[model samples]
Target: MSVSSSLTGRTLIVMPAFNEEEAVGNVVREVKKTLPGTVVLVVDDGSRDATSAVAREAGALVATLPFNLGVGGAMRVGFRYALENGFDNVVQVDSDGQHDPAGVPALLEALDSADLVMGARFAGEGDYRVRGPRQWAMKVFATILSRTSRTRLTDTTSGFRASGPRAVALFAEHYPAEYLGDTIEALVIASRSGLVIRQIPVAMRPRAGGVPSHNPFKAAAYLGRASMALVFAFIRPKSIYRTGSNA
Candidate 1:
């Protein structure tokens, strides 16, 4: 089924790009083809390359950031754009071409009964060519998150995901600003705030170019910090209730 026919509301795909000139255009094109009528937005996170221009040429509405705001910052900008511009659903996908645009429908389909739908690379028959150490670290983090959040999460680091109105509002208000732990963070926050979260297996492609931003030291730091963040986030009382009415 086509994306337009599947979705009951407007769906916007947000690509957070940083020096991804080579892949942005193709990524936008594939998303447009797979999800007809889906609007694309490229948040150029201070890319020194022609990422913005390529995305624009490929039919994405480009939003340029002044400096490198990291992935979380770029996604926050996209969330704001989606919220203010009145998009009913928002999907955050990377511009590095590792995420399959064709699988966007699966994510969207999962969103029908979930407040947030996350793509799980570990759950399906896909060539998940992740580095050994990074994969191990992700597994560890996923275990910790699942325990703390009282939910099962196969891929805590997957970036291919979709969010509905409640999630859009929550992220726009309180998405983490730094690091690659936003997936786990979002899941924990959503669970605490009583938002329904679901995950579906999706294929993840090998990265196209440039070294993956994660190294051993960086991975250690991320694991430590993300674990701490999740602990604090779990213990802290939620300020917002699950009900629509804010009491």
Candidate 2:
């Protein structure tokens, strides 16, 4: 995918981080290298480390939240920033360095026909093989979401995604503020709001540092909470999410 020719609209890459000092800098640098001239914004979720400073030094625009807003909140801030700054396209890349920067163009290329494009590690060949109960939960949610949205989705919990202007505006207004906010809830919002969702296979690297976001217990609870959120999304009026976009 040739991002240079495909991205005629202004683009912003949003990286939400929490205590990702060890990884954020290199992630920022890699993103800049992959998509030169595209704005990279790091939303520091009140990290107690040098994450913000390192990200700034790496040449990214930084926004430090006064407190931890979780990934969803941090990303909401990013969407708002994108909208306010006239960015027509937005991409969410995890700051933990798990997402490969080279796969960015695939998402952007998919965006040519999709309102939102997700980089699905499980959709095709990938290095990050999810296992155990979490893997089971992902499959269950993927099935449920695909059936509900009438679109096949292999990775319902994947955070790697690109959004168009309409998605950027609606999500900036009412993004889910809970666990799996960046993944399940955001996808539900986009589907219900009339956005076309597509998936492209992308490989991912392991986290650079820190523990995984969820343990076994939390993963189960996440499935339960996500189920409830899905119910709410289905009942919500679709007209409420409609936004004007030239694209």
Which prediction has the highest lDDT against the true structure?
A: 2
Per-residue CA lDDT of candidate 1, range 80-189, in tens?
A: 88889888788988888889888888787788789888898988659675665666777887887677556688888788899988999888767766575366667777
What lDDT is reached at residue 93 by model 1? 82
Give the runs in model 1 whose Cα sits over 4 Å from its true position: 5-9, 129-133, 235-237, 240-247
TM-score for each model: 0.89, 0.91
lDDT scores in order:
0.80, 0.83
The clash tally of candidate 1 reads 0
Residues 3-55, candidate 2: write the lDDT tens digits: 78347348899999888889899999988887878889999999999999999
- TM-score (C-alpha, index-matched) for candidate 2: 0.91
Predicted model with the maximum TM-score: 2
Q: Evaluate residue 10 in candidate 2 and report its C-alpha lDDT on the 0 to 100 scale.
A: 87
State model 1's lDDT. Answer: 0.80
